[model samples]
Target: MVAVRRGDVVVANLDPTIGVEIKKTRPVIVVSNDSINQLSQLVVVVPLTKNIAHLSPSHALIPKGVARLTFASKAVTEQIKAVDKRRLVKRLGILPPALLTQVERALKNTLAFP
Candidate 1:
């Protein structure tokens, strides 16, 4: 299995949903600590959306083509989740450290964690 490290933009299978589901196989950023990611069967991730409306600290916009992405996307901190590593389809690219730090901050704010 490929190692999933923090900051990796990965494709995942996110189907079989319930209400307000993010749905479908999509791009997600691995937000878990690298140590835990190496040892656990599941990895934490934040989903991305193309929607740019109502941007806030909780929603950091990733510039177009960052990590070779085709379009700009917003990291939906509100939609953070964890899933089996098997759900990861492919690693797209690593997000730059500085932006990832912004994501971590947003995650903290969204989750109300200290």
Candidate 2:
């Protein structure tokens, strides 16, 4: 059981989804704080996707290889979700400071943070 911390990109099981929810097993960014991650059974995450053609404030562009992602992807901030920690397969890598900062900004925008 490795430590899953905020800013870490990890693979997760997001199957059994319905409607427009992001489906299948995929890489997701750990957005929840470290304290909550340690105290709670669920881990908050944002799914990544290669669909970056149409950009919006709801999506954060993430460069390839930044977090062990082989392809350039978009962080679907609007699709933020919380899944059981057991659903996390393995850690890919951690987002660097600059990228993580951008993610926070995008997340705030998606959440209408002041």
Candidate 3:
């Protein structure tokens, strides 16, 4: 597969090495900078979970039927992590540029920036 860009939703293998884990295969959004993604073997991603209750400002709800997901999912900003590009299995679809901007803003908030 080609390099994934920001806002692109893809199926990812999230098997953990140890400890409490949100492991296994799941849908994730590529949230890394495009330039870095082009050069690095790893990219940052946010896992998408079906749980959508009490979403914080940092969590963006991906509505049902969007992309390859049959049900609504929340992009759990707090659970963001970097994974090998190989972990990304298949490309589902790309979220809109506007929504990506909102995601970026949410990330900034989640990460605590001025």
Number of the top lDDT candidate: 2
Give one digit per residue, the lDDT tens place, for model 2 in 1-114.
546999999999998898999988899999999999899999899999988899887788899888789999999998899999888889999999888888888899999997
Q: Which candidate leads in TM-score?
A: 2
lDDT of 1 by residue, 1-114 (tens): 558899999988877778997878888899999998999999999988888788887887888888777789899999889888898888889899998988998998898999
TM-score of each: 0.93, 0.95, 0.89
Off by over 4 Å in 1: none
By TM-score, highest first, what's the ranking?
2, 1, 3
Residue pair clashes in candidate 2: none
* Steric clash pairs (candidate 3): none
User: In order, how many clashes per candidate?
Assistant: 0, 0, 0
The residue pairs that clash in candidate 1, if any, are none
> Which ten residues in a row are the worst by lDDT in model 1?
62-71
